[model samples]
Target: MEPLEEIDIFIFDTLTDILFDKVPGYKEVVDMGENSFFSDRSTYLFMNEFAVYLGGQIIADRTSSFVESSFD
Candidate 1:
């Protein structure tokens, strides 16, 4: 298996933080993916959700609310 890149680690850590705060049994869910090579449906769904959330976070982080307000 390939090692996770730096960005992958960042996303995983961010997702872990978010999931640990918001979801029950997140460790089990993550373990399912890690153990199964992500063949499980639950793991797949969680990864998809994490990716979407991370994408949104990245966009939000890069954008300035002040800049947005200037256009109004």
Candidate 2:
């Protein structure tokens, strides 16, 4: 078997994340929410979009206190 570079692990890990509907980031870190995580995106936008849909809820599931209390 060939070796995998450190950064290239995303190529494999991202697919696993989609298949399992999990992200290591969310599992290991608390308060880890992403509104726009495209900075580290794939070459095509559709690919990234699809990944997000099946990769579980990393956004829109969290609510801020101001939004909930209606005070800012």
Candidate 3:
């Protein structure tokens, strides 16, 4: 695999693991062929729907909100 491909795989796998393990009730943690961690050529996709569902909420919140910086 190319370096870029390997990097993509690592990042995707890490995110999936975090989404399912650290996050709660995250469904659809696995990336199916459409958004697979391995590659576009990947044959299958697996995910936990509950984990992804919750993780989506968390990710959405992060993307939607901004935090203020304190001078202290």
Candidate 4:
């Protein structure tokens, strides 16, 4: 795989790893108002959602969000 492709895989896998493994109830935490790990909930949510966006890139393809945009 190319360096860029490897980077994409690394980012996507890391995001999923942290979201699914490290964080407990990450979806709920992102949505909850009381959660104040950062300056505010919106910041936290935006950061997480943006990471997911970079990792997922759902809008780029219809089949799946995690699909890489790189050409074979």
Candidate 5:
């Protein structure tokens, strides 16, 4: 397994925050290895979802800036 990059850590941390908000005591479960919530498959899915969401946000921001600049 490769080491996590800064972005990977950020995304996982964001997901952890989201999980913690939705599920009480989720952080405790995640810390426990036996029945970890951040399993391989779950991590993969969360990473993919974060990437897509981030990408779209970036594109939208860039587009809005471009349009604003063009009008200025």
Candidate 6:
């Protein structure tokens, strides 16, 4: 499997095809850095959108669920 960054780029490319001819920069702002441009609303929107994009992908599910479960 590719690294997280590669997977993210791949998904971003695919989403651009479905949503628009050009991918919006705001759509790719969900970085782990403290200074990411994405607001809370943008973060949630991106997350939900990616969840729908990655339906039935166990790697994605495990990654998210592991983090979520760790916080529980």
lDDT tens digits, residue span 1-72, model 2: 245454555674575355224343333222233423344433344346534543444254335432232221
For model 2, what is the C-alpha lDDT against the true structure? 0.40
Which lDDT value does model 5 have at 22? 52
Please give, for residues 1-72, the per-residue lDDT of candidate 4 as tens digits. 799867756665565456545444444544574334333324345456646644444466644423332110
Which tens-of-lDDT digit does each residue in 1-72 have in candidate 3?
999878867766775566445433232323332334334422223334333443565566644321111000
Please give, for residues 14-55, the per-residue lDDT of candidate 5 as tens digits: 866765555433344446553433565355765454445445
Error of 5 at 21 (Å): 1.2
Q: By lDDT, who's the top model here? A: 5
lDDT of each: 0.49, 0.40, 0.41, 0.47, 0.51, 0.43
Cα error of candidate 4 at position 31, Å:
22
Runs in model 6 deviating more than 4 A are: 21-72
* TM-score for each predicted model, relative to the true structure: 0.33, 0.22, 0.38, 0.31, 0.38, 0.27
Q: Candidate 2: count the clashes.
A: 0
| Deviating ranges (above 4 Å) for candidate 3 | 28-72
Error of 6 at 54 (Å): 23
- Point out where model 1 deviates above 4 Å: 1-4, 29-46, 49-72
- Checking candidate 6 for backbone clashes, the offending pairs are none
lDDT of 1 by residue, 1-72 (tens): 346555555665675566555543444545656334333324445577555544554577635442232223
lDDT of 3 at 25: 28
CA RMSD for every model?
11.1, 11.3, 9.7, 14.4, 12.2, 13.5
Candidate 1: lDDT of 16? 57
Model 4 scores a TM of 0.31
